[model samples]
Target: MAKIKYSPEEKKTLKSMFWNSGLVFAGFNMVKMEGNAFALTMSPALEELYPDVEERKKALVRHNGFFNTHAVMFSLIAGITYALEKEKQTKGSVDDDTIENIKAALMGPTAGIGDAFFFNCLRIIAAGVGIGLCSTGNVLGVLLFILLYGMTQIAARWYLLRMGYSFGTSFIDTVFESGLMAALTKSAAIVGLTMVGAMVAGMVNVNLAWTIKVGKTSVVVLDVINSIMPGILSIALVFGLVALIKKGVKPVKLVFGILFITIVLAFFGIF
Candidate 1:
């Protein structure tokens, strides 16, 4: 990884890759997509880390953005170049230590923003805002969603590229360690939670199939329960699922269990 500085030609190749790959609209799946692209693009750069083709392939698979995985290589390349240049100037040439340092320093920060902002906040913001407007069935809603989604993505590319170019070696220090990161994370969390609230109201599937009759008045009972404990139920459900995952139950199994319960209860008019 020592000789891994982006030459002019390499920069051109990577810039093209970034722009092209960033056009993908896989929503929440963007993290995995970005990771795959990073692994492919950074193969040449990662020769020292994974010298053998088989090893590299394994790394590509292992490093792929599975659950809780997110790191974008294109942006990290900027830090790579900065570190390499600094190392070369200090030691009279670039070496493996420089590349390893770049990887060590940038990996955490990239994963943080790539996972939190790009995959979670940005995707949710775009989809939530888009769906909110689109549900109105007006031409304005369609236009607004398209414009907002496109602008957010474009901003993502621009900011990532700018951070890559400007901070290079110090981007992580400047972005993550600064209060800005906390503020942004908090803000994004607020927005995402709000969106989740909207989604529960608009999208969550909890059927109230049973009814209660009192003195010639028949009312759907589940609706009353839902209205009384909407937020609490949502929080409990999320924590319960997270606990199951922590207890080593697979995500697919959890999904199937939830679906099964929903179906069974709905069938018995008890949902």
Candidate 2:
């Protein structure tokens, strides 16, 4: 069977749609999550492919179901979905259930991998570099970060969209067989953890100024703690916060709690 080819203009249009409308309507509901934005992103392609009002409506409705994933990584899924829809339109071989099933199966893994790699690793690395530069009072640091991160995302969207369309279902099998996805996920996670650790070590400060007088010798509390284990207090604080989070403490409450503690400690000369 001859494969359908999208015009350059159509490809450009789809890319624009995915980039612009990806997260515009993101929300949580009982019916669907991110469904409205997903449908909106694909509306142009659906309209172009299915000229019949009923057919277009069906396509739109088919996509307007529970859909949640990393907002950017979903572009790859969108591309594959568009290709599958086109195939269904032209060949009538693929079914709606297959399409929905593929989306449901892929969204979770894609989101997990995407969040670990892009959000935790790439974003943190970019922010670290940008912030370091910004501390020097250079405005270019902010621009550099925006440009670097934005361009990478845009390029990934464009490339993944094209790759998904070109390979369709075969791409999934190819990725699994090659083991590239797993390797990437693992490597990104390691790097992300290392970077996060570095950030915590540099950013978190816990010092004790109190001293104990023993036999006319003043021993600094912070110095003793440092001698025993540097950054132990900081590490403990981080773990404490993590435990609180795991215990269902709301983030806003945690923020205010930290603020209150800091204020009280500073006022009492205990920090």
Candidate 3:
């Protein structure tokens, strides 16, 4: 048989697919760190009791299978969506299940790797180095920041593209069926917990209340709720919002509510 070759139309579809895949990969990398950390922080028992290396080692193929699945899935979805939106193709036939499956299958794994590699490793290292070079706010620091951050982003793009184009198309099902998914999910849970702990300790803010004294007897009492765990209240707030979201509340409405609450608290000097 003659060597099979992708036609121009297929090539175009593939390119578009990879582009969207790359965008999801990049966007998640930028935002998933905090959430991942929050998850890790809140669940130490799960992390500690995570399965051993031998099991994971056996499931190595499954572990790295997303690269292939994501590449092909995204490429095809991107192509289909483009056809639907741009070409005004048969919109009715586009099933919700297909879209949801694409999203659900990819998002969790994407968030996990994005957090570990991009958020935890690259961003943390770049920021740490950047801060260190603050005193030397010379051209060197600026150059270093630009170079490191740019390189990290570039590398992410390259790797994700490779995964999408090569592995995504070839080994999608075998990867999932290998029982590696459970292990990866567990690893993600562990990492997420650790990330969350770091966030609670670093990102969340809770401070004691200060009040003016009456007469000479200065009445001072600690802000008990805030004092116990400074970030707990904020974490609880997020959890409440998430619960609302899970119950079908719109994210836009939730955003507005969070903003309103934040502004009110700030106005009263509480937050």
Give model 3's TM-score versus the native structure: 0.41
Per-residue C-alpha lDDT of model 1 across residues 15-66, encoded as one tens digit per residue? 6545644533332342243445544444443443345688557645543432
Record all residue pairs in model 2 with backbone atoms less than 3 Å apart, i.e. clashing.
none
Model 1 TM-score relative to the real fold: 0.42
* Candidate ordering by lDDT (highest first): 2, 1, 3
* Global local distance difference test of model 2: 0.73
Worst 10 residues of 2 by lDDT: 22-31
lDDT (tens digit, per residue) of candidate 2 on 1-271: 2354778866776776666554634554433667877788788778877989998999898887657777667788888887778767876655676567667666767888889988988899889888998999999889889877777877787777766666774553465568775553455455545655664697678876677889989888898898999999999987897799789886568778888988888887776
**TM-score of each model, paired residue for residue:** 0.42, 0.58, 0.41
Q: Which candidate is the best by lDDT?
A: 2
Of 2 and 3, the candidate ranking higher by TM-score:
2
Candidate 1 error regions (>4 Å): 1-205
Positional deviation of residue 4's Cα in model 1 after best superposition, in angstroms: 15
Across 1-271, the per-residue lDDT of candidate 3 in tens digits comes to 1222555654554444444444443423222322222222212212222255553343232222212223223333333223222211122432333323343344445555656766678767887777788776655666677678666565555444434434433333343567564454455456645554554566555443544478986543334455675567667766786699789887668768767977787687554
